[model samples]
Target: MKISEIKEILKGRMLCGEDRMDAVIVAGGAADLMEDVLAAAAKGCVLLTGVTTDHVIRTSKIVGVETIVIVRGKNPPKEFIEMAKSFEIPLMVTEYSLFVACGRLYMNGIRGLDGSW
Candidate 1:
């Protein structure tokens, strides 16, 4: 699936990287712990998280997450969004909780990076 498809699936709001919405999305991972995400996320993957902080963007940069979906209607700080923009990372806002978001993606054929990374 593509990131744009995810936006449509979740009715999410794109906060940045509008041009990147069509980027290919091969897989996804859900986690609030940046440490875990950094250790396991695949390259070019989408990160689903409830944590909204500057550290999230920093971790994403280090871990190679192309897009971030902030769950539960949470909004990252303005500075963090600006930072993500500067770094060319796409940010999305979804009202669905993390579990529901993950489930929806999975049900729609979005797999995790397990073993395929």
Candidate 2:
């Protein structure tokens, strides 16, 4: 599903990158470890995490994740938002827990792309 669809279904707040919500998200990875994200996330994927650090943006850029969803109501730091803009990555803040959010997307038919990494 498109990022826009996920936003509407989850009632998520668009923290940034609203212009690219129509971007396709064939896969998603939820993690707090920037290293893991950088190592495992697919190109053009959406990242889901509760982390509010600037490293998240850096990691997203290195891994080519175009979208970020900050789960569990955690707001990203201002610096991170600016970094996201500089990197042209869209950011969203959601009240849903990581597990619930992933489940909702999965139930709605958002599947990972095979061998996309």
Candidate 3:
């Protein structure tokens, strides 16, 4: 799925990297634990999480996440946004919970990194 379509599905607002809206997301993953995120091998995936720390942004970059969606209406700090921008990773926020956001994306045909059915 395209980042634009994920934004529409999650009703999220772009926090940065709007130019990357065309990026392709082959999968989705939701997690607050940075270790689990890294272990998920979420390359080219859209990550959904409630954690809005700079660490999250940094981890996403290292893991090659295509986008980061902050759930439950939480807004990432300016530093986090700036870091994501520098990495060319799109950041978005949604009013839904993490579970809901993941479910919506899954229902829309996005799969898990582990290829779960």
Write model 2 residue lDDT over 1-117, tens digit each, in one string.
Answer: 788998986779987888998898878778888888877788878788889888888888888887999999887778988889999999898899999887887778765544532
- Decreasing TM-score order of the candidates: 3, 1, 2
lDDT of 2: 0.83
TM-score of each: 0.95, 0.90, 0.96
Q: Which ten residues in a row have the lowest lDDT in candidate 3?
A: 108-117
lDDT of each: 0.90, 0.83, 0.90
Off by over 4 Å in 3: none
Q: Which candidate is the best by TM-score?
A: 3
How do the residues 37-72 of candidate 1 rate in per-residue lDDT, one tens digit apiece?
978898788999998888889999988898999999
Off by over 4 Å in 2: 112-117
Model 3 over residues 73-107: C-alpha lDDT tens digits? 98778888888899899999999998989889999
Better of 1 and 3 by TM-score: 3
Model 1's C-alpha root-mean-square deviation from the true structure amounts to: 1.3
